[model samples]
Target: MPRWPYLLCFLLICGLAQAQSLYLHSPQGPLRGGVNEALGVGYFLGIPYAQAERWKAPLPASGWTAVREARYFGNACPQRGVFTTRLGGYLPPQSEDCLNLNVWMPLAAPPAGGWSVMVWIHGGSFTGGGSGEPVYDGSRLAAGGAVVVSLNYRLGPLGWLTLPALQAEDPQGSVGNYGLLDQLEALRWVQRNIRAFGGNPQNVTVFGQSAGGMSVCDLLASPKSGGLIHKAIVMSGGCTFVRKLEEDFTFGAEWAQAMGCPGADLACLRQVPLSQMYPPEGSVLANVVQRVEAGGFERSPWKPHLDGAVLDKVPLQALKEGRAAGIPLLAGGTQQELWGELLSAPGDWTSFEVRAEKVLAGKGKAARALYQRLYPERPREAWAYFQTERTLLCPSLEAARVQGEWALSYGYLVSYRSSVFPDLGSFHGIELPLLFGTQNTWPAQAIFLSAQAYEDSLPISRELQRRWLEFARVGEPGWLPYDSGKLLEMGSELKITDNPYQERCGLFR
Candidate 1:
């Protein structure tokens, strides 16, 4: 027994040394990455945290006896137009097994305390984004003093597919929300192995914009996601896109039936070519029901569903009932023209006005009157711009109110009129470049919204980054929790302002 104990101790020491060693096995073949001193970070990209059989749900990665090559980005999950290479520049490639994540650890050998963790979920309307986006480089955030991570999860049809048969066949008996499941799995990965990367498994903040923000809301409301994260930062989209279980499930079933299999037929759905499963278009679908699914409330196109497993209820209800985990939450929306550029390509201003009315009606009459008074001189083209507040800003502000009393709730209004489109004022998606502080990388319309030539917004970007870094380390972003009386304004200036209470925005409370 004494001899066996000695042997065990010797083996444990060897394994520890081997576990700390790093290597690479990229598809392009072997390569090496090392620790950076200036950035004070070490990054290992393309680490696999989960796996899936072809056309099947993701499974825990096969355990390996040896240290794994976490060096290369695995092939991205298959879906329609997930190919970011077409989004213009800096997009990598795509694939069917893209279950991977990237890590950024402090450059130092060992810090006194485990580094704080910030896991960013990239947003591309839930259909077309990945961790591979260049702007998502984790080194900057990690070097700023936390273990920053960005990851890839299944997206689009491959993710939210819901069918009765799939549910029937479910090992967990849950339907739809596979992409969300993938996120939960990633969080599980962080909880289980992040200590190896110098991250405190217990402390984490999940942050994202647009669809990623929507995902954050889903997770926040999900029972399955209860203790995985300590805080959340929701950028643009949140609590807006709601779905029904039957509608999504029925749609999945019809698609399967059209493929010659009928009745709760998940087997057939899984076998179909992914492209055939989810057709692609050069557009982002809003919460509006489609012409096909419009007839019934049950049919929603490619969004999270009201399945009882992961998401038990919608965000607003969950918040009111106090089902939320009560984690500190920081959420905000960009100022005017939020969805303008995205909607401009094909639609007319009248159609845009119709969208505005729908969003306002949902917000309430008080918001409508206040919005009209604020934008009394609304230009024909600018109609869409004002709608941004109704559709996004006010809604998010109200959500901040809910968390303000119980948890630290900080809100900011992105009001710096973009230097690029100084004429248009601040526009939609303006927060992206600003948050990443990558103003130099703007595209055509995005360029118009840049703060480049103008010197005023420079300090704002720096300050915002500082606050974000502070949030990454400590829960508060160094501001008073937004309250009914005072709200934080994140513009060319940061100050307290009266909450917008006289409009549809009031319905949120």
Candidate 2:
């Protein structure tokens, strides 16, 4: 036996294990990808799903003859560093040509048709976030007997800007939903290419957290998104308040004036740099909230609005009217939501009242009185619960209730708290670590849990992943529909609970 032959065999085996190359013809074009034999998964990274023309609807990915490399992650859609930094810097370099998607599939080939598919839409309030974030790695989820896909869409002013000049450019006179159109384009891409990656396009599940979750609701409501997605899991995103493209130009006018552009000057607006679209230095969060309080729906000039074309009505209204896509829904929220901020001083009833009054606004007197009556001596707990119930819990319950009229809707309240940041409770987005199974990662540790806490959360994380994957596989996570407005509280223990803020929600209703 020749040593040369032995060396050649070793090299081949090593190549197969380290970077097993795979080539496939997809609807867009032939793509090249790598496989992780150790994990028993195949990875196709940074494949362009669509192309965008600034603020216009996205076009399908251009076909290619040569095998396009999908080894590295795609460029993140252009957004301010401040936003990503606030999120603990999980996003990648920004680019306008960032409408890319990634795929993960089991090493084994699909059976008759294909494996069930889970498409992820990252959330950053419709202004930030991309598919390339480290937490969104789909390998672990894909390894569990499914194919997973994550995609990027436009954000901020580039994605959601509305102007008469831009609308004039549109033959259909529809604008302001370019980011949503990007999502639709990605789903269409999945229908075309996912089968090649061992995924069943017919049984697709669209899942996302925060703004991504809101996107899921929008997809469910929009007539255009019908049949593109089969099931939806909306985490930490509410559907109660939907805004219209209000004729009042408080934001649009201010933004245009700041950019030295007229309300109708699309070209002039386009020339303004990406950095200019962000709020003034160190005031992103405050400015955004202030603007939103001032009657704008977004911190930036971007956010989903009831565009007559893509979104004809509010999602809740659509669901009520049975105009939304009749798809199974799993809507959930965290136990704390913005409760962490309120819990810092337990006995500060004055601060609590002030904050509570501000949060309740028009209904402040009623909410304050009800909250004070419910937990008179426990202002801290009351404030925390008030934050959770009003923003996350009640909205989710209400959304589920409306969805029940047209589809099977399940509601969950994540109450698992972190041993590291115990006060944080099940704060907003706490489920990301558990859901992504990234509790051990440095980013997750820094923001979400301590090492010990992460270890402690492993079981819950695994269970959460299992439940989500199960739901993706079969439109149910072994839970009953929330027809009666009962929800599963996912905490140290799982039990059914009536809407926590049914009375408070009644005020809104």
Candidate 3:
């Protein structure tokens, strides 16, 4: 009955157990992995799918002569240690040589067509995330009968830097979007090599949360990325946002000035050490930037911008015009995001109306009236809920509406509030552990679950994983498409409901 037993059992199963060796030969070379007997899964860790130089597209991994040991995770992309991934543990030393991926294969024999593959792209504002986090450990998912993958790409200025000088120097005339290129390269690797790991490359499903989810959206609209991602799931991913290459280059110019180099000096910029590009921690600028990115409220400087080659135009516009890849899409967000509490700031009727007016801007009157009508007494809660609708939920609805018109599409709202951080509501990235079925493995329990909700959360976790795996296996996740303007609200009662905030969303549109 005690929780300690469950905790200890999970630790014993996931860690400290001596692993059995497993081997597989692929295009790259023979890879050596470790088997978790308890989970009946084999893990191939930290395998490089490509090699990438700074400010350049990734190249295929070099040929290997010997059996490479893939028993440990590769380096995470260079990033500040501001955001805590998964358990908030110490990360492995960051590196530029971080274009690696991890794979998990079921020990059980595959079916006739091979197991379905799900590639996970992590979220850290495109500046701080790696595939090595424990919460993303794929052994459990593999055991549930699928091939799982997580990968690391370039991050920060290295991943998305744009400069007129660099563009001029490049033969391809492409600048920025290296991180996205790394993802494409990884998918190509999967197409070439996943068959060796008992995975059907043709049945691949790409899914990610937050920034990674935004990458999925980009891929949807990118002609270069077509046929690679068969099915897609975008979790906590916002839509209707993109930047021009010129706009992004301005940030590069600022970065150049900060580094004491001329904005147009490509050679000088390349010569600067990675450490000096971004402050690691403790600096005022770095702290402010980290806070804003972490808030999940605004676009961070380090993100995939509209490079002419990779992305011809904004994804939303592409989707609207039916230029998007038109694959099956599952996109939605949490019930409450980082702006919820701030939007819910204590205020009188007049102040609440003022704040609503400022937030809604052009569409102020209707949304504010709806908020007042919905939560007459709880003005703060109403405003907070409205903030989520305006920024995340409604945009996601628009995405679903657009995709559903042409392709099989599903939408969900993770309405299960965290018992731990009740004030934060469902919060961003909260669905990750649930989807991975690793909520208990989170090192910081307070951030994920409360003592009272620990046991109660397991069923929810299981259901979420089941639905996601279902979606990966087939295009459908046991839910109807949002064609009827109904979304599956994932909470204590998982059922179809009319999509929320229709009136407010209409005003925004």
Candidate 4:
């Protein structure tokens, strides 16, 4: 056979495949999407899901008559700071008109009903991050016989600011929770339109990390999210952590006053420049943290809050009362949530004991005895483990236990240390790249993992994807539920162990 003939045939097949995956008819309109030939996935990026004005509820995206090109990502919601710039490199153009989402679906024939849908929400403390981040690319996950969707909701002050003036304007007097409302609207968009993209609207799973995880819990609790979400995966986010809208009113007033709009004058506040929204010397997060400390509340104020109309009760309370019954829930965090800064320096058993004594002040002696008993010999690691349990692991487990009472709930703990950054052992967010199979796209992988380490982690990555896909498909992640008193532990080895940290967590309770 002539080599030229073979080459010509290959080109013809490639052209036909490209044409076949290029266009699709959506309920909203005709869309032109791009395809990853190598991955055999069709991607529709930057599709507008809704439209909203600052401090207002999102409205359905206007239908488009012409074919819209969804080849590039949409604008990220307005955000600033090192978290947005240095860490994720999400330097896309910013805008308030950013209620858009991206979708990736397998090009192959759909399963019996339709492909299971997984919606991703990125996390940056509710102030930064967007669906456009490179690490969030859904091609690999979508390639695993699923439809993957990621969205951009409002962030920072623009997304959450609440004031009396704003409340009075709302018919229900709703305040704060605007960002959460954006998420709800996105889910509604999915239900109305996902089937057009070869997804099962009834089998949707919402998953997120950090602040995004927190949003998942919020959605699970909201009556507005009823029937829109079937399964939820909350990573490193506790269920019970939310404040009342009234609590944020004071902060909002102060912020407005600081911006020269005393009394939260809506007219004047609306006129403030975007640059002034997040001043360079101090950030909205810093200001909120200061107020949070002054108000004596332990939870971060930047996240979603209970606006009476949007959320009737605290998420955990709602779960305990069976408001979210029958919804399968998967929730957990890393083994060491805040390892880098806490364990950055060298320390010995004596040093750890001294630090523990100071921190435990009133109960120093008893605390020391308990610590010694729980984590003997490895004194320095004890502090990191305790902090992790208190901040991420225990809270997550507590939520799972409560959820298990009315639903099939699972808990997980990721203890897989990176070979390159061994000292940062299973630090916060280590599971993301592994689950998405986006190790090559993750910024941390470039900085930390060598090519060989990336290769070695492939099996683990694939396993995570399989487990998560199975959960989305059949509401089981190939393990027993949390009520069984066992939780899956993912690390160098994978196993289901009797719940760890019961005694340690009890101390906090």
Q: Which structure among the candidates has the greatest lDDT?
A: 4
TM-score of each predicted structure versus truth: 0.81, 0.88, 0.90, 0.89
Full-model lDDT, candidate 2:
0.75
State model 1's lDDT. Answer: 0.64
lDDT of 1 by residue, 1-509 (tens): 12343244324423433334343333233323444445555677777778865335677665554446554555655544433345563554676678888887765433444678888888776767788766666766777677887888877667777776667677767767788888888898888777656677777989887778778878888888878988888787666566788766666665456555677455665576654444444333322113333442113466777778777788756765666646888888776635444445224434444555564455444443444566554434344545565556665666677766567787877776765556655655666665665555524235534345445556776677778878767788877777746655677667677655435455433
Residue-level lDDT of model 4, residues 1-509, one tens digit each, is 23443244324433544554567668899888888878888899999999988798889898888989898999988876435367556446888789999999887766656789999998888878889887788998999889999999888778788787888899887778889889999999999998777788999999999888888888888878889999989999877667787777888888787777888888897788777776553667547535533432244466677888788888878888988899899989998887753654226555655665564456545555776687787666667776677666787777788889988999988989888878778887888888877787647565236887888788888888888999999899999998787888898767888887667666654
Q: Rank the candidates by TM-score, best first.
A: 3, 4, 2, 1
Residue-by-residue lDDT tens digits, candidate 2, 1-509: 23443244324433544447866556677667787767777788999888887778888877888879987898999875434457575677788889999998887645555678999999887777788877777877888878999999888777777766666788777777888899999999998877667677889999988788888888888878877888888887767444567642456656676566755477787777766565444575436534543543333446776778888888878878887547788888887787764637447566676776676677766766887888888887887787777766667667777878888888888888776667667777777877777665546666444566656777777777788888888888877788665777777656678756568767655
Candidate 3 lDDT by residue in tens digits, 1-509: 23443344334434533547777666788777888888888899989999977788889998697989998999988886436653476466788888899999887657667789999998887778788877788887888889999999888888888888777767767778888889999999999988777788889998988788888888778778867888988887755555678766776776777666864577787787876766657787666545534534264567777777788888878887876545788988888865546644756556766776786676556666777888888777776777777666777767777887678998888887777666667777777777786776645356555666767677887777778888889889887787767788877646678876567667666
Q: Compare candidates 1 and 4 on lDDT and give the better one.
A: 4
Q: Could you tell me how far off, in angstroms, the CA of residue 184 lies in candidate 3 after the best superposition?
A: 1.0
Model 4 poorest 10 in a row by lDDT:
1-10
lDDT (Cα atoms) of all candidates against the true structure: 0.64, 0.75, 0.77, 0.80
Model 1 — which ten-residue stretch has the worst lDDT?
Answer: 283-292
RMSD to native, candidate 2: 5.9
User: Which prediction has more favorable TM-score, 2 or 4?
Assistant: 4
